[model samples]
Target: MKLEKELIFPKGFTVRKVIELVTANERFASKIYFQTKSHQCNGKSMLGLMSFMLMTTIGESYIISVEGEDAEKVIQFWNKFVREIHENTTLSYWEEEGAQTVQEAMCQSISFWNSSVRSVAQSYLKPGKKEI
Candidate 1:
């Protein structure tokens, strides 16, 4: 079974705070994952959570989905947690995609190619293959 919900946080709530709360409850945290359009992270990892750069701004939405036996309980916990922390926060659906400048594109391209996994798998991974 799985449980899922979408939510936003309060302006004062930081990702670090999220890390503390999520990790504090190991049993619940281990059963869930959080996702946004471009990023997904384990609820229990500070670094993984940081990599998403989650913000408490209006319109940005996050999806919390949990698996395993306690999925319902974990989902309920996160739902209540977000509501309590961000009572007055507005909720909206923000489109997370957009175009970028030529310079920005170049930088992103370089970053992807130079990223740890990409750098190592450059030769092994490619756009297409002729097939056998």
Candidate 2:
């Protein structure tokens, strides 16, 4: 089976969120790839994802292709993951102190990657409903 979807990063989206996607890909047997206008890379590779991210900006759409026995499952996971990221970005931007703008929230999220406060930002990445 094979599935593909075009998805856009919501406001306040950061590289750390890409890490979440890469991590999730590890659970499936699917061979997943992410494509931007100028580049394409394996979804399971952090370096590839980072390189791909460089060619795009927030709100820009990209295509994700998944193929294998678990393609449907991988697609479902992405749908839920993207929805959660959007919802959490909205909530975190408004709810977190000192984050008066979406960009601030994004910067804060990047900073979270290094400190103990990472857990706080990571909470935003948690799936809202049941896991796929």
Candidate 3:
């Protein structure tokens, strides 16, 4: 099984959040990849993620692809995680930090999904196999 979703980095999102995401990915058996328009890397690899992050900016969108027995669950987890970040950032800036108005927060927040969830047939190779 394979599941994919495009996600935008929310406001106040940082490298620490990416590390948290990668850590969550490591907890599962599923293989995950994060892809920007110009690059893609294994979501489970710290080095790969760090390199990928360097090329991406806040508010940039990326696709996350998950494959293996837990693909659906992985996708679900990511959806919830992203939503939490989005909501928390919005609320924190508006209410807690008082750095921005609610309107400003809403406008500045990166849109989480530019596209809907896509289910596709397996196309990525397993470990030790070249991707076709």
lDDT of 1 by residue, 71-106 (tens): 887877766666765665443322122112322443
Candidate 2 C-alpha lDDT tens digits along 42-85: 98999987788666666778898999999989988888887877
In terms of lDDT, the poorest run of 10 residues in model 3 is 116-125
Look at candidate 1 and tell me the lDDT of residue 24: 57
* TM-score of model 2 (CA atoms): 0.62
Q: Which parts of model 3 have CA positions greater than 4 angstroms off?
A: 90-132
Model 1 lDDT on a 0 to 1 scale: 0.58
Model 2 spans > 4 angstroms off: 90-132
Q: Which segments of model 1 are wrong by more than 4 Å?
A: 53-57, 88-132
Model 3 lDDT at residue 112: 39
Candidate 1 — which pairs collide? Answer: none
Model 3 pairs in collision: none
The deviation in Å at residue 108 for candidate 2 is 28
Candidate 2 local accuracy as lDDT?
Answer: 0.73
Candidate 3 global lDDT = 0.71
By descending lDDT, how would the candidates be arranged?
A: 2, 3, 1
